[model samples]
Target: MTNEDFTTFPIDAVSQERLAAQGLRLGLVDTSDAAAFDAWLRADLRGFHQGDPSEKVLKEQREGLAYRRTTGVWDETVDEPVVPVATVNSWPANLTVPGGRTVPAWAISSVTVAPTHRRRGVARAMLESELRTAAALGLPLAMLTVSESSIYGRYGFAPAALAADLVIDTKRARWTGPVPGGNVHFIPNERFVDEVAGVHERYRLSSPGELPVWPLRWQQLAGLTGDDEARKRGLRTLRYADEQGETRGVAIFKIDGGDADFTKHTLHLEHLLAETDDAYAALWRFVLEMDLVSEVRAGLRSVDEPLLWQIADFRGVKAEVQEHQYLRVLDVPVTLESRSYFSDGAITLGVTDDLGFATGVWRVEVANGAATVTETTDAPELTLTVNQLSSVLLGGVRPSTLLRASGSPVPDGMDALFASDRTPWLSVWY
Candidate 1:
């Protein structure tokens, strides 16, 4: 990758020209300079608050709980100083993908380049720089919802998942017959963290496409990340456990209001994990029953989520479809073994690498819940590239689909091997 000329310090016109002539300079935006970048974001994006109390209030009261508990893509990487010229700063909202299970990936926020620094490749540099940084960080993948899809493909990022948003009226959400079961209670957000984990883990282990939430991610969700507004909003984690004391599901949300004397009760569900349809119905019923919350907003839900269908009055909900996270295979063997595959026995296959995840052939042995992957140059039955491998890895994009695509290699028995149980469906994005 060619280094860009842009640096932390302001560049002169002549220096800018020289840098532009050579190529753009790309670099990380140091954390020490976060304030500067924040300022740039506020100015560039009109209507954005200048870190005011109102924004804090909004965060504290409405958005803070979700940001604190919910894990989305915005992080230190997005702040990288080197800007690319092609950024749309579009801030596309929630997106959905239907692969057996519905997936919710929301990209509701973003910040781009300064006007003076525009046209010089700030956004492009920033975008590519973040991809490289994410790769180096060992993150399995990176994703963003975009109005301009053309911009991200150049950096080896692809649309791996999608989601849709829905607005429903409570009066329309007819509560069906309730299954007498787990008791629901209002608990402190921090106290309910474990319950949330328990429920989410149940789903995560069974779900093909969900990523494991790290400790720091939970901390962030609980408003424990030193974001003051989140604390003030009284953000609490809500959980429902069975009589045996096992947590079935949890929802993170708070009460909200606007200036127009509207009492808006929004539930920004950070994570809703339930194994059964009954558990899901009960949990959502609990939320809708909250006394004052008029409107409920839940983020990161799968498209065609059963909750909507479960509600008798489906029209009460309004939804918008959006893009969420994107995935790329960095290390083929490691990637294959990271998640559980359904193969019962061992098989020798010749794997191909078009995106350069790995080269030559590999022998992968799967037994029980374990797998052994080794490099092998010997002739084999199947051959496929990194992209194709990634598609098959999730089970959403079939091996047959990859073979059908132009330039993809054909392999015998590959379809049967991949079609074992069900195609993988990642319910969440990193």
Candidate 2:
């Protein structure tokens, strides 16, 4: 079916049929039925190898489920409580695109299938259902942070962004940046939910590949909820305000491993959000200069973090980069037209999709920093799979690089048109 026709496509029927053929039933979880949803959450957790969750944890999860669209697959042949063998959910979000525009996106998460259900197409059915639902709701893109890198590519999701894990030897490093004129102070953990949420909204709106941080995540970071014991141990929240006393940044971290030797203490950064450069630098300076802390470690950070350059000794900070967020275009024309382009040009893209959601040749034209995409009969200048297109859509991976690696045909100057000024980075995990 054409991309436009997919809006009315009966994906639910397809999902039901596919699962029924395997003697399974796909159904939505009733958010009000805490016991049923909790069982589903436990099954999902077990699929991920997590131990049984506590009652407190189950309650927290149930509360958060109120904000998400959740679905599950159950074995109808089994004569037991109808708990799901697989689970998937999506939250409504706005993804920041190029030129500071936000596009409505469905953020998919909690995708899990029990070991018993593996190889039974349970995950595929749920994923397909989620994508089709998003398309029907008029969302042009769907995104997720994957637990396994190799699993999503076949479904047309590609690594559109990257992040880094940073370990800084604070004892050996010196700050070389201009003295940040901001004041950093400790804030009560309870204030983190409201304070950081507001700051993050401002930050994510201007940052590419960023999505809105949900309320549950904010509470989890603030130590107000969740089952992570490591996050709560020695947890502290620090706020950075400009010299004018306007709060601009906040950091949640925990201090670990300083029993005998104070120098053995490590500051593990859980979440840090800054609205301005001065505030960012100020927070880093605060952490790097903290007493008794030997090293500072943070993960899921943008690969292009300026702190590496701000330090006098760059070698003291060890950084490991890894692929993070993946994006899939549900509608080729709408997805391309939604984002701003770097240069003015026209190219016919022959997009092949096994799922048939984004398959077709379309002419994508760019002019004056804007783009227009339309289906065309003209011969395509470049032919690639939907996964490859997604990889280069955010401008993180160059089309030329993929072409050279795969030995695929390349249109001249395609790299220039696709390259972004800044490397795309995703700082949060779903």
Measured by lDDT, the strongest candidate is 2
What lDDT score goes with residue 266 in model 2? 92
Compute each candidate's TM-score over C-alphas. Answer: 0.58, 0.94
How much lDDT does each candidate structure score?
0.50, 0.83
Tens digits of per-residue lDDT for model 2 on 233-320? Answer: 5689988888899889999998888888977899999888899998889988888888989899998898889998888798999999
Q: Model 1 Cα displacement at 333 (Å)?
A: 2.1
TM-score, candidate 1, is 0.58
- RMSD of every candidate to native, in Å, equals 9.2, 2.9
Write candidate 1's Cα lDDT for 318-354 as tens digits: 7876655455455555555555555545556554543
Model 1 residue 255 lDDT score: 61
Best by TM-score: 2
Extract clashing residue pairs from model 2: none
